[model samples]
Target: MRDAETVTFGGSALNRAAELRARPDEIAALLNDPAARAVPLWRGKPSIDGAGALGWVAANHPVLRDGEEPAIFLGSDETGPLFTIDLSAWQPETGADPVPASFFDATEQRHPGLPDGHRFAELRNIMADLSARDAECAATAKALIGWHRSHRFCSACGEESGVAQAGWQRVCGACGAVHFPRTDPVVIMLITRGNSALLGRSPGWPEGMYSCLAGFMEPGETMEAAVRREVMEETRVRVGAVRYLASQPWPYPSSLMLGAVGEALDETIILDPNELEAARWVSREDMARAFAGDHPEIRAPRRGAIAGFILRNWLADRLD
Candidate 1:
């Protein structure tokens, strides 16, 4: 766990500029600054350049226009200021990344200023490849954008909400209600009793691809309690001595992954069909092989994931 913060999208330490975001004029000033930069998203996919890095455009890039309301202020870096603009409405001329045919609104969008080979890449596909700072910025923007899309209406009064607080909040002009973005808490546990740890796969995951037992923490539930409950509910393996290990920001629509290590009191796993498709214990040596891509039957959790982080640390005896 020496380099625990290196976990993908775990802790990039972006400044966020909370005070600057509170000033209406500063927000506008930053947006208009010549040195300011912006990241573009089409159908929620990030723009990537030929170098396989985030393709940040100048604030004045033609793809950015003033008419777009709710332009999210993503805070400033050493490069002056930053923002994000959703270009989903703009149609591409040619040679753009095609929206997945399965998408509800299928179309391709490519910005003219972007290099010929530059295109929108889904974060999930490129997260592991991105530098820690780039990954954190992109994930933060994605989560904020998604929140704006889904929470445009006031939850309390059922009225429309206007973007406020430099893209961090929505204000209902009608009822004067203010709402903030939410981050769902999930507990992903590495439960071990002896030399083996427990892993489980949901119904639709690829065959042999399993991860730590994880679930959303319910109301009034402590993190430790959530871990124990999720383990027992899914596999009937009673867990003890649950404690925090590390955390990751899983920005797939904004969920915080709270990694934990738990001691299993009983190794007998009685799977609950509703919670998991399959659950079992895997020996440490075999798990190590899985991490090295040589396991005969089990596949390691995806790299950069908290599951992988916890498993690797456990294998290395670093979870003390």
Candidate 2:
């Protein structure tokens, strides 16, 4: 596989086995199979061990007993069929609760039922350390479970929806409306002109941390167009000749980040205060220092994010 394809939360090529979603009996039997294992999540955080590997427990493990919903069928591998169970209902100790509305949550929650090192850790904190297969599985589990939590009611009719297809879908009993998981597409572009790259920081991001500008794709807009539009709207930077580089399944509430590079037509930056707290152009040399943790006023983008992936590739001339 190309280096670009190995971005975190992608390129695992796991057999999703979508056909099996409709087979309820087969899925039920697989749940009982001794070889089947499940990854558990507590309030959107997955269990990770001290070694940074995702912790898996047998499907019938006591830690999974309290989830209000059925286990989500991820896919099959040589080990057997894989599943994920949501334990959001499992609350932690009083002081260990997650901070509300924080940009980064460093709190770790350990269930009494789980082993000592198997604590539910924030995905972003451990994302760079997970194996490709573990990253894919964790992303899939987080996205699917989050979708279910937010979409419990049918939009067509104000009726509560029920889990169906082993968590792949929701069925509205009142209106008979069937719904599938939604993935919002966001374009994150590394816009460049000459030796400098345009980078921006959002309001709540940590100080001195800047990354490629990104925004959600509007309806009926193409990826290239989204890239141009977002940059222009946020920084008034006109972008031309956009090209796709890579993609990552960012499951912080389920977004597929479309990574791209755009040539900047001008060096002028007019920042919209509402969209960006600050914006600047950094030369290749300064960016290298940021990545190496040597820059005094600038910090590197979050590790395992597509922004960092694309920027690193651009710096190495490996975006191909």
Candidate 3:
């Protein structure tokens, strides 16, 4: 977990410039500045040029028209500013098909103009391949765009909503309710007593693809408690002394994965049929085999996933 933030999309300690987002006038000024630039998103994939990913906000990207004027600004990162564009006032070019809600997948495609290795891939894949900054950009695009899509309607009064907080919040015109983006917290833990760790496979997962037992953090429950409860409920493995490990912001519709290591007090396997297809303990050596893709009966956890990361580290006795 020491190198957690080093992972792609693990967050690069970016300065989000919270104060700047609150000043509408300043944001407006930046949007209209001739020197400002844009980053076009086909869905959530960033536009790339042959010169590598074109520097956002300093080069050619998509432009958001604000009643004939450009109205977008840069989003800052740990390294510097990230280009963002507002599409509220723009229409599709003549004969050009608008990007579909699903076209976010297109950004991962290899394009001619993209800098070598600058193609869009799933965040999971990107985490394994790209730098932390690239992953952060991809995560930002996905989270912001997803918020835009889901908040077109106000949840409070079932009326329409408008963007606020520099795309971090939605304001409902009808009820005057403000809605902030949500990141659901989920706990993924490796439950162990002696040398064996508990793992489970969901019903629809690929055959033999087993990973750590996890569940969403319930309201009012501490993270450690959630890990204990989830493990007990799923595998009837009572847990004690839950230890926090690391976290990953899973932007598949916005989730923050809290990874942990739990000590199992009891080893009885009572699989909850509703929660998992199978649950059992695997020795540390067997886990190493799984990681190496040598286990004929099981597949290793998916790369770049929190589960895989945790399991790999656990196998090496590095989760301490």
Clashes of each: 0, 0, 5
How well does each candidate superpose onto the true structure, as a TM-score?
Answer: 0.92, 0.98, 0.80
Between the candidate structures 2 and 3, which one is better when assessed by lDDT? 2
Compared with the true structure, model 3 gives a TM-score of 0.80
- Which candidate number would show the highest TM-score if scored against the true structure? 2
Residues 137-239 of candidate 2 have per-residue lDDT tens digits of 9999999999999999999998999999988999999999999999999999999999999999989989899999999999999999999999999999899
Give lDDT tens digits, candidate 1, residues 1-320.
56778789976778889998779998888888989888888767788888888878887787667325557888777888888877767666665546554322234345676667677777776788898878888888888888888898999999999999988999999999989999999999999989999999998677789899999999999999999889989988998898888888998789999998999999998999999999889989989999999987899887678898889889999987
After the best TM-score superposition of candidate 1, give how far the Cα of residue 251 lies from its true spot, in angstroms.
1.0
lDDT comparison, 1 vs 3, better candidate = 1
Model 1 misplaced regions, further than 4 Å: 66-68, 91-109
Looking at model 3, which ten-residue stretch has the lowest summed lDDT?
Answer: 63-72
User: In model 3, what are the clashing residue pairs, if there are any?
Assistant: 37-57, 49-113, 50-113, 52-115, 108-120
